[model samples]
Each structure stands twice: as structure tokens, then as C-alpha cells.
Target: MRSKYTSFTLSIALAWGVWGCAPSTGTPHPPAAVAPSVPTSAATPAASPVTSDTEAGREPPPAEGGPLPSAERAGGHEPPPSRFPEQRITLMAVGDIMVHDEQLEAARLPDGSNYDFAPFFNQVAPIFQEADWLIGNLETTLAGAELKYTGYPMFNSPDSLADTLKQLGFTALTTANNHSLDRREAGVLRTIEALDRAGIQHTGTFRDEASRNQPLLLTKDGFTLALIAYTYGTNGIPIPKGKPYLVNLIDPALIKADIARAREAGVDLVAVALHFGNEYQRQPSAAQREIAGLCIQYGADLVLGAHPHVVQPYEWKTVTLESGMSHNGLIAYSLGNFISAQRRDYKDVGVILKLTLHKGENGEASFEEAEWIPTYVHYYRKNGKRQYVIYPVSLTLAAVQQGQKDPALTKEVLNTLHRLEKEMKLHLDSLQKQEKAS
Candidate 1:
């Protein structure tokens, strides 16, 4: 398949206060609250020169000793140092990780315990582990093994899934999806508990008021990012009496309100992870575009979506924040399935989107670049049991290159991506206009 955003460059920079902040679990504990703020040096928005291999789909070279790009100077437009600490952060986001009954059985270990999913996820571990921050969607509930772990109908996954995800460097998980309440209240509570125990942060669903309003804070490379998540509904699950706030639903009012609260909390970057749209359909529905535009109009810095179970085109757009500052943000309408039991043509593959944040010498934050890495979920049928596994495929690798030589698989994957791009091109151009106007 062809590479997306090949012109973008990925780099790691730690600009003074922008370099090393810890990922916060609940409410943010700002640096000033813990220790005295250090005087920071001016930052530069330098990125390494792009190479052919990176554009060809090979992994970008390591950042060590790589030259940093020079900061953009307006000659006289520089502003005063930003009061909020400027940070250069790198984030890696994947799509849905749905655990079906078949894959759960494959996770069965030798001892009496259930499945150990470490091996199945070994392939993409490096990519996740390598990034300063990793994010993805969890489509199944972690309500324990005694509960039947079915696939499509309703899912109650093993809590072990949380442990496996954390060990693989998944810092945050979006609990918002159509299956958020597969087992109703039990499913929601169990999933939260399991993620808590694993030390993995989660959002989109909560057990109480405190959890519901909790802000997911992560410090990577030097930037502090606040992530908020919401889903369309909980499989038609009614909001329990007196607990309407237990789960995040797809209400524009709710989303805008939550975003306002997050920004007030002093979050430098705000990311909204939304789960919407029909399954397996390549293009985003009209409803998807409308809602996404509204989100950008609000205070959202970036929006990542899932629940479509197929790769969707991403657009870099310019949005005005509540602060009245206009800046560019990346939005992936849907990432499809990072790993699942679905076995079909387009449903089998996923994309890995890499994002880098930068700060100029003026100390203002901006999105530097983004790149999409194509990946696939391999299926194996053995011992009369079918299992699903995830694999990260580089776009320009020899195997992928050779696979592209095949007219069938290559044509299908490339065609779907092209269609997605075509649908979003106008939106991207509109975003550029907004940026220029600002």
C-alpha cells in the first residue's frame, strides 16, 4: 500500500520544561505544585531532514545525534515566553483491540490461569514501547473469565488483557465504544478496576462521579497532554437511575462541557477520542464529519476516532481553541481494528499513526508532523480453533513491497485508503485555509 504523509518528519525534542514530565493518573499535579519552576531556555522547532527510506515505508532513523531543524523566525513576530511550560511530546495511537472468545482461548496458558496475551501482541510491542506515549481503544469489557467471553454479540474480556497492554507500554486506553457496557454495570466496573490494577490509565467509562470527571494526563517527551474520551452509546444500555454519568455518551453538549472542564484544568494539549460510525464501512458518515467539525470548533486539539472497524483517512486541520489561538490539529476519523477476530477483506488491516508535537523559539506549542504505518492482524486456525494475532507492517518493507506486487491484496487495500483520502481532501484543504487565515 502507498504511504500517507510521507513528507512529514518525526523527531524527539526536550525543550527545557518541554522535555520530561510524568504521566499523571488522575487530576494533574502541576510542576509548580510539586516544586519550584525552573527558568527555561527558548525552544527551537527544528526537525531532521526527511530521508527516502522513511518515505518508502522504512522506520525513521533514531533521534540520537540527529540534527534538529532550525526554529521558524518571523523577524519581529516573536512573543514572550509562554507561562505554561512548553513541551515537545511524541504520541503513538493504534485502533481497536477487540478480544474475541477465539483469541481468549488462544491466550490459554499452561497453568490453571487463563490466557497470557504477551506473545500474540509481541510484534507491535516495540512500536508502542518505543514511543513516549501510546494510546488505543479497548472494545471489550474486562469483567473476568467466569463470565462468558463471547465475540461480536457482547464481550466480557479477561482482566489479563489490561496487564498485557500495560506491559506493552500502552499508557492510556479509551474505554468508550459500542461495547462499553457489554455486561452492563459489572462490565464497566470490572474494566475500570482491571485497568487500575494494571496501572494503565483509562477514560470514556467510569464507576462514579469522581472517576467520571477524572482527567487522563500523560507527560511524554516534555509535553503534558490531557485526553478525554466519549462513545455514542453503551449498546443501547440505559443510563442507570441516578448514574447517568457512569459512562461517556455521544452528546455534543456533554463533549463540549467535558472539553471545557479539561482545558480549565491547565492541559497544554487536549485530545478527544471518539467512538462512532457504522462498522466495516470505509468512508465516514455525514454525521461523523459534522460532529468532528463541532469538536474542532470547541477546544479539542486533536480527535481520534474508532468503532468503524476499518482504516479511515486522517486530516490535519486548523482549529481555534477556547483561548482564541488558532493552530493545526490532526484528526483520524477512524483507525479501524488494531487487532480483532474479524476475518474479511478490508477489516483485517489497521494503521499505526505517529504524532510529534513541537514548540518554537517563542515557546508556543504546535503539531510538528504525523505519519501512518500500515499494519495487519494475522489469523491462524489450528486445533479446530481460530485465533487472531496483530502484526506491524512497514509500508516499504520488502515483504509489504512484494505483497503490493500482488494485484489482489494490494489493489483492495490501496483502493480503500485512496477512497478515504479522496473523501477527506476537501476537509484538509479547508483546514489549511483556516490556518493561513489565522
Candidate 2:
């Protein structure tokens, strides 16, 4: 998967950690020496350079067992003031980050081993740097060299992907996708250890009983946020004879129970990351809609989805809590592939959905507003020596809404995202129409 930046202040991180008492053990390492941006094949001369070395395949020093650096240690440039209002908690969520074979091969160092990914993330780090928190789906196993790494059918990515993720501003990552157990049981343990060492947090797959029972909690901007992750299946991989707890599955009864615990703990917000839906499908399935509705009813405030390997529509959903209280939530049905080798249509385009929650003067917290950034991942020159570099489309909706010099290419990307969005809209509309008729 590709890396991007997200920024926040160190003081804020310290304040949150002390106040919330959530262990901040695995924070990402600071960014490294300066570098130049690798201009994309399709990039205009005016496009900003992608400067971070992580994107360029440089590795950062290990961040394990040291006194954590100040919040500035969190890599990436701070977000603009306008992006985050005062006294609010903002979260940015992205889709699947699949580390295919090509990525690993490119990441290999001179020692004939995989290099760490933290450095490469420094390039696009600014995008996520500003949010109070960031989330993404890790669609590969961290099984290390003991197991071979491959793409498509099964994936065992470099363990260093966790370090890259932490540096890129991800507080929590979901591991409950179809490829969750690509290397079997060993991959699960190694992945968790890698994340733990980097001080990054994770949910979904677990190596043991303790990891399985742990609920990832992050306190940001005076709000306590809880994250829970689950997937529909494990690419048909058996969950080790009697180990149903190895990975979380989307079970309604279990989800309701989990939400109940979060609410009882008085978490300010509850976010559910679901690895569901069909591969490359533009819209959510009936099962996805039903499960999302169930999450809302059970007290989840935001729902992020994945496993489509392509972009899906986003919706602003509101539901009444069991206490007869109304609340707003964002259901990003699917975020598509953040960075991958996939050349399929909307599969190359994804959305970074940002949500903010604020505590009003009256001591009440409410959902504020939401924004979506449309991104495209244009593969670098696949023909020859420059095959390793992949340029994630950085243009905004405003930029793409206008026609491009290459109308055909622009049309292809936008049309794919738009069609997916339309599919999501149609599903919602059908539900609304049925309600009216009833």
C-alpha cells in the first residue's frame, strides 16, 4: 500500500495520552533526511514534488523502547487551521493499503531483505498529518521472511509496513480483511508484534487471547474514541481448528455486545471498521447494509468499510439511539484500494473521509461536519526501469471536476468513482422509497 502524510501537534498527543491513560507505546518514528518528490508520469510540471524518502524507498530508524518524542515527532506537516476547528476531534479514514509483491521487491535493501517503510511515508505525509486521528485497512500479512511474500491470492507484506503506517499518521489500522491470515497463524502474531513495536495500534486479527480482547482506544482533542474491526471472511482460510478468536467476523449479536461495552465505558465516540462486501463491487451488498444498520442501532457513531478493493459510495447517516437520542454518523461503505497494483477502474480511486466531533459549550458532544477527498493512483512507468514508483492521484474534487488535457484518462477515473457513488445513492434511495410506500 502507498503512504501519505497526516499532521497533529505533539502537545495534543501528550495531553490526550495523559488524560485518557491509553497506552501510547507504539508511536511511529520521526521523518528522515530531505528528498525530492518523484514526479508522476501523468504529473504536470506545476504539481508539487513528492519529497518524502519513504515513498522513495528509504527506511527510518527503529522507534522501539525509547522515550517517545514530542508530538512533532509525529511525521508530516500540520493541517491548515481551516481543516480542523478548535475544540473538536477530527478523524480521517482511508481504504485498503495492499502491499503487493512488487512493493516488497522494490522495498528490498542491499542486504537482500525488505527495507522498513517509515521513510517512504514521509513524502505524502502532509495529507493525514492534520487530523486528530487517522485510520486505514492493512491488507497484507507481516509474516516476515520466514514465509514468502506474494500478491493476489495471498499476501505476506514486510513487517516494516507498520512503521511506515505510524509515521504516515495512522493511529489505528484494521487487520480483518480477506487477506487477514494470508500466512496463517504465524502471520497474525508477527503482524501484531510489528505494530506493537512501532507503537502503532491495531484491531481485527489477534495472536492471542489478550490481543483479541483488547479494544483499541485513542483519546484526541478531549474525546475518547473506541475502534473495533471485523471482516466477513478470511479468504476461505480456516481459523485454526478451535480458534474462532483469531480474527473478528461480522456477527450482529457480537457487534451489539461490543458496542454495549463501549457505551457503558462512556466512550465519546465508537467507530467500527468492517472488512466486508465483494471484491471490486462498486456498491455495498444487502448484507453490508443490514450490518451497517445494525451497528448504528447498537451505538456505533461511525462505520468504515473495505474489501471491495475499489471505491464505493459514502453516506451521511443519522439514527436514533436506544435512549431516544438522535446522532449523526458517516458510513463509508467502501474506500477502495489506497495503494495497490490493481489497474481496474474505480479501484484506482479512493476517498479519504474526514469526520469531526465537538463538545458544545453546554457539555454536549455532537457530530460537526464531514468532507471527502477523491484521490487517484496512477501507476508510474510500468514498462521499464521506473516500475517501482506509483503516484497516488493528489488532485481534489475541484481540480478533477474541471476537464483535463487528457480527457479520456480523467474521464475514466472520475466516471468510475461517480458510478460507484451513484450505485450507493441508488441503494439508499431504494430504501427511502420503500419506507415512504410503507
Candidate 3:
């Protein structure tokens, strides 16, 4: 019989195609440095640089100190000094935030007027707070109690979920997914409203056509980012007639246009969040790869994917556009479930993907580094009350190895933690090696 650790290694090797064998020895690396400062609650709209293709051909404004020296002319004007101060911003993204029936029941209060999800994220809150921007995929609707809160095929979670996320330092959320319209048009609108009230920025779904037309632009530490989100489909629910802008649907043409708009707006970075691929699968499907490549070619600097419910591999690619301009982009196929009731092999495993964007003194922005922290959802019962908690797999493994006793650390949970720590170390090490080779 195959050991669980062997099975775990094989599963990751199959999905990633990079890990040749498990590490022979060595303690797992510690987590990366936490973010330094808290980001603003909301990003202001940046001034547009170019309005249309006609204006796109115009030259950019001269530098503060003037033009650079001419190589042909001897003793021409000297190069100008760098004006903008160097800045770095950290962004963290996680996968599906699903609310199942059991989760809702656990959060229910005695009077039933409200739900408290604050406890669910207690362990992970500090990690998230370290990031300049923490983003996630909200896989359920917050359509209020009028819709009779439920879960599963059609999920309508309490608005308190959004509130709890905001309180825990969630900078933004991706609102496009199969369950975007679970409660129909009303649900879609209500979800946006709830997020707005909680002061959390979101994209992929809109309350009006005008809002949909605008890109979700965020500014932090002198860097501006344009975030766009799209889903493959809405679980076969027909979008209301004459309201095609309710939810963003995956289309190359539409995606290209949005990327162009972001460029015209002069945003420093363009990040695309996609809800695609087969559920429970650990590998990126053909469609997922093709679409991700297309987005990079269209001018996206990074692509964050979800909806697989299972963690997948990530890679960095350099894409050359039709105009002969080449750009480097990062593609993370899937992130799995951040927190949920699922107990399947990889279903409970997730990652907090972190990337640092550095803006040079000359106003040029690029990705400086990338890393991920593996996480696991721990479910346990205490005092006759069920609880769902998230734990960083590496830390949990360290604790277990030390023979510490804790109510939440059961034998099965410890096994899962060990498997996760090994798999994550191997996966991340492989990625680092590939990056160095490239």
C-alpha cells in the first residue's frame, strides 16, 4: 500500500511536472517577511494618461530634469536624475472563500439575527495583516436575510462574512465565480452593496453599467494597479436581458479591451483574476493555459486563477505581443479553498500567494519577488461547539514535531499538516530552481 506521504508527493509531482523527488533532508524554510504597513481602505481613481487609440501615439511627458544625453552627439545633455522615490508594495491572494451549510450553522447566533465568522480567521489574520493588499475570491453571495440564507448549489451567506473579512484586513475581493448569480440579479447587486458598506473593494460584478465600464484601479505606496476579474460562466444562469454588464464573462475580446483600457489609464500594473478550470483537479486545463497566455499577451503583468477547489502549479512566462513588445508575467493556475468544510485530500489545502512590486525612481514598476505560504483548514469541536480555523502548515508541523498537545491538533490533522509542509516545500523549491535556470 502506498503511504499517504508518497501519495501526496505523487499528486503534486503530477500536477506541477517540476518536482523530481522529495527532499532528502533539511528543515522547511520559515515564512517570508510580513508586510510593513497597512494599506488604505480604498484607492483613488488615477488620472487617465490617454483617452483613445488616437491619443495613444502621443509621446509621454518629459522627465522633471529633462531628456537623456544623446549617444550620437558628444557632450550632449546629461541624463536626468531619478525623480520618483523607490517604492515596494506587497500583495497577497488566496482562493475560494466558500460558506457551506455547516459553516453557516456554526456562525449562527442564539437570536439568529447575525453570524460571527471572526473566529474562523483568528489564526490567519496576523499573516494577512502583514500584506499591503490582501485579496480573495468570495465564492458565495451576500444577498441579505430576505433570501433565506442557505448554502451549497445555491449559496446566500450572511453579510457578516464581508464585515468580518474587512475587519481582518482584506483589501479587496474577486466577485466573479459560478455562484455570482446564485440568488439571481438581486443577489449580484446586494453582494456589491454589502462589500461597499464594509469598505472593501471588489471587481467582476457590478451594480450599474457605468461602474462596470470602469476598471478597478488601486493605488498604494506610489504604485497604481488595475485589477480585472472574470468567470468562465455563471452556472448556466442567464444574465438579465439588456444587462450584459452584470457579471464579467470570460471572452478574449472583452479581456483584451479591458487590458488596453488599463494601459490607457497609465496604471503601473495590470492584474487579472480568473475563475476557470475543472473543480477538484490539481492541474491547469488546456483552456486555463490558453486564456492565461492570452491575458499576458494583452498586457497583464500577473494572472491569479481560482475555481479548481484544489491547489495548482504556478509559473512565470515572457510573452511577446504582436507589436513586438515583450513583457514578463506570472500565472498561478489555481489556489484551492482558503477556508471551507471540505475534508477531501487536497480540498482543505490552500496557499497565500505573495508578490512584491517594486517601483523604481524612474517610475518603472516590475515584480521583484514571489513566494507562497501553505495553509490548512482545521476543523474541531470544543465544548459542544464546532469551529473552523486556518493554520499555517509549516508552523503546525513544527509544533507537532515538538510533541505539543493542543485540542485542534488531532492525529489526522497532524498527518495532513506533515503532507502539506513537504509538498509545499518541494513545489516552491522547484519553482525557485526553474526561475534561476531561466
Top candidate (lDDT): 3
Cα lDDT tens digits, model 2, 1-438, are 112221111111111111111223422111121112222212222221224436534443337976433433676443333432336667888889887666665566658756654433432466676678988999888788768767777988766777778777888888888887888888888888888887878898887767666677888766788899999888788889888778999899988888777766777778899988887877678888888878877778679999887776654455555555554455778877777767755666666766555553333354444445545554443334223322234333334546444322455555654554444334323433454466
lDDT by residue for model 1 over 300-369, one digit each (tens)? 7678989988877665544444444444445688887888878775687777777666654455455544
In terms of lDDT, which candidate is stronger, 1 or 3?
3
lDDT value, residue 249 of candidate 1: 82
lDDT of each: 0.66, 0.64, 0.76
User: What is the total number of backbone clashes in candidate 3?
Assistant: 0
Q: Highest TM-score, which number?
A: 3
TM-score for predicted model 3 compared with the true structure: 0.80
Which ranges of candidate 3 are over 4 A from the true structure? 1-81, 399-405, 427-438
- What C-alpha lDDT does candidate 3 achieve relative to the native structure? 0.76
Model 1: CA > 4 A from native: 1-87, 110-112, 319-325, 382-387, 399-438
Per-residue error at 114 for model 2, in Å? 2.8
Could you tell me the TM-score of candidate 2? 0.70
Q: What TM-score does model 1 achieve against the real structure?
A: 0.73
Q: Give the TM-score of each candidate.
A: 0.73, 0.70, 0.80
The residue-level lDDT of candidate 1 at 108 comes to 74
Backbone clash pairs in model 2 (N, Cα, C under 3 Å; residues 3+ apart or in different chains), count: 23
Candidate 2 ranges with C-alpha deviation above 4 Å: 1-86, 116-123, 386-438
